[model samples]
Target: MATTSPSERLLKTICGSCLILAPAVLLVGGLLHPEETTNAARQFEIIVANLGRWELAHWLIAASMLLMIGAVVGLAHLLHEHRPTEGIIGGATTMVGVMALFAIASAEAAIVPQIGRSGDAQLFASIVTSGGFWVLLGPVLLLPLGLIIMSYGMYRSRVAQTWVAGTVALGSAAFAVSLPTGSPVAFAIGLVLMFVGLARVGWSVLAETDEQWHHPPQMGAQLAG
Candidate 1:
């Protein structure tokens, strides 16, 4: 019996983290919409414990951010060196960027004071809607874009159940549409679907790890007889 190497362990850890984060990213981000019910933000604030259990929620959100950051780093690494089909790298990188933005927004929402404050709501809304918020559109748009790319990549790689890849694209599109409509429930459902799609991707990747490993060759050339 042989022991696992550090790189292998790290890869597994990263993949595991991504599997866990796929849904969470969607969940926390789903709650950041200002257009949703006023209670939406309030609910998130309370979820983050800014209202009821301050210390507990604060730690929870902080931990969530840390985990997301780690997952993003792992995602970046997984995409950085891999020679996937055209646009797959770009698309996955875009997803990483989106996750980064989502993490930032989550952090902002988590730490802000939840108590009564005049004019703060208006200011927050402006911030969330302006370029700063609109910049979020990059990630928002890229999620589906990346999913489409990943789906295509899987198809090109001749992987089974290619149809599953399409779910990410569909889910992202649904989530995007739900946003402007001011329907948090729809957004949550969309994210749930997106997570399912991601889970499929994760499962496929993990299950096929041995079949997919692509480590570089050692620096030596040998002539064939």
Candidate 2:
């Protein structure tokens, strides 16, 4: 096994840590989100009353999403090295899906929560029913889709063990299936599977110098020059 270069090691570490942390942050945010009551106004009031915590959760969620984007991009680079063609497809899918999810979350973080804080029942009611709410659900499935695709790519590329690949693909699919039903626990668990799968591949790359990553001129300059 070839020892991983310093630059490669840094990216793997980032990928391992961030992908692992992303789901945790998401679960915590879900737990922090206000539960709906029978009264619409009452719900808004509750969120407003706990506005500080609500905003904090959104901020954390936003941060986690940003971290995910970084991790995914890093992982893509690794995958491209493992299997140039298929790895690109897998990594690209994951990157796009995760990016979409992140974009939606970031948008909500910027505006949707502010509506709750404003204490406007009419505005809240109107906004919540608007396309904005549905848009949130739109990106939810993309994440799992990407994960499943990436897992398949990993398996095909011989990037990880069969069991690890199966776990990632199954878990990701389950996560997608569970989302519409509003299951945060399942999503979090699915993320754990992906983290483990990525870890297996990442560690292999880190420990084995069999795979070498060639950075472009600009990137090489940034990392080594």
Residue range 1-225, candidate 1, lDDT tens digits: 235567876775666457567556546545543333434345344433333343333344445445544443433333433324434564555556566555654555454444213325545555445666455555655655555555455444434244554665576667667654656666777777767766654554454343243331111111000
Instruction: Specify the highest-lDDT model's number.
Output: 2
On a 0 to 100 scale, what is the lDDT of residue 79 in model 1?
42
How well does candidate 2 score on lDDT at residue 19?
54
**What are the lDDT scores of the predictions, listed in order?**
0.50, 0.62
**TM-score, every prediction:** 0.61, 0.72
Q: Which regions of candidate 2 fall more than 4 Å away from where they truly are?
A: 1-9, 36-46, 199-225
lDDT of 1: 0.50
Residue-by-residue lDDT tens digits, candidate 2, 65-101: 7776655665566457555565566666666666666
Separate clash counts for every candidate = 0, 2
The candidate 2 region of ten consecutive residues with least summed lDDT is: 216-225
